[model samples]
Target chain A: EAGVAQSPRYKIIEKRQSVAFWCNPISGHATLYWYQQILGQGPKLLIQFQNNGVVDDSQLPKDRFSAERLKGVDSTLKIQPAKLEDSAVYLCASSRSGLGDSPLHFGNGTRLTVT
Target chain B: GESVGLHLPTLSVQEGDNSIINCAYSNSASDYFIWYKQESGKGPQFIIDIRSNMDKRQGQRVTVLLNKTVKHLSLQIAATQPGDSAVYFCAEKSRDSNYQLIWGAGTKLIIKP
Candidate 1:
């Protein structure tokens, strides 16, 4: 089966600029997740979508980070007015279902660098 | 604010030796735990998982031991190889977290030839 796919393997932008990352989940997966990983750290969940409806966004920095999974298959994560601290890898993941013990499949991720 | 953490940030093991990585989680309610391996320039890949009901589970070359009483989880890799060099992460899913998995800071595994 095809794994989750992400676009723009790497990105570089100045602080205060805007950037967006795209992701395509595996076929038939019903749940999508966005995560931010800082250097030498684990991935932090930014948002979660269950078939286009948001299931969680408690950890997302709403002021600067936004994500949407329209049509329940593809997702886009955007960072507006990107701060120097926003430089990190943005990852996208999907699972067979949002319930139960299903494992998640992840994409390589978009490495964003803010200068 | 529950969190997961590892005792070591990095571990170096000679090829063909066994490796064990330890993790401690603060959420007692978490019942499901998973181990992930992430190579450089790639995303995390699921390695093995264990539930609170089971104390241990084994995969082809990996083992996951969960100690619910102490909130500790360990991943053991047998006959470590160069391909095993990567960052390992532990994540937990609490019954009340709406299926969200809480991740811990990863441990870098280095394989010595």
Candidate 2:
């Protein structure tokens, strides 16, 4: 079985610039998530989607960060006017169920470096 | 305000020895827990999971022990190998957050040859 797939394994951008990362989740998975993981820290949930609809995005930065799962199979996370603090690994994960029903499959992640 | 954190930031163990990583969670309502292993440049990979009802769960050479009363979780890797060297994180499913998993800072496990 294929795992979650992500694009642009690594990215570098200057402060004030915009950056976007894409994710393609595992087949048949209904739950897709985007997380931001800083160095030496655990991942922080940015947004979550279930079947093309947002399930939760309370932690997302509405001012500059936005995510969408148009077809319920692929997702994209964008950050405009990137800041130095935005440098982190962007991880995409998918699960078959909401919570405990199954484990989340994660992609390798896109390492973003904002200078 | 609920958070999950590890007792140690790093654990060093010789290869072939057993290793134990500990975590503490503050949410009493969290009913599901997961252990994840992440390499230097990779995302977290699921190791094992245990429910609040189960005191312990085992998979292959990994064992997850959950203490609901104390809100403590531990992951045991038997006969630890070099491949086990990575950052280990424990996450708990939040009951108030629509089943969102809250993560810990993670513990880096270093294996000595």
Best of the candidates, TM-score: 2
Query: How well does candidate 1 score on lDDT at residue B56?
Result: 96
Q: Please give the range of 10 consecutive residues that has the lowest summed lDDT in model 1 chain B.
A: B94-103
Model 2 Cα lDDT, one tens digit per residue, A29-103: 999999999989988889989899998899999899999998888999999989999999999999997766467
Candidate 1 ranges with C-alpha deviation above 4 Å = none
lDDT tens digits by residue: candidate 1, A1-115:
9999999999999999999999999999999999999878889889989999998999999998899887889999999989999999999999988875888889999999999
How many angstroms is the interface RMSD of candidate 1? 1.0
lDDT of 1 by residue, B40-109 (tens): 9999999999888899999999999999889899999999999999999999887688768888889999
CAPRI quality band, candidate 2: medium
| Deviation of model 2 at A9, angstroms | 0.4
Give, for candidate 2 chain A, the lowest lDDT window spanning 10 residues.
A97-106
**Native contacts retained per candidate?**
0.72, 0.70
Clashing pairs in 1: none
Return the lDDT, model 1, position A88.
95
> Residue A36 in candidate 2 has what lDDT?
92
Clashing pairs in 2: none
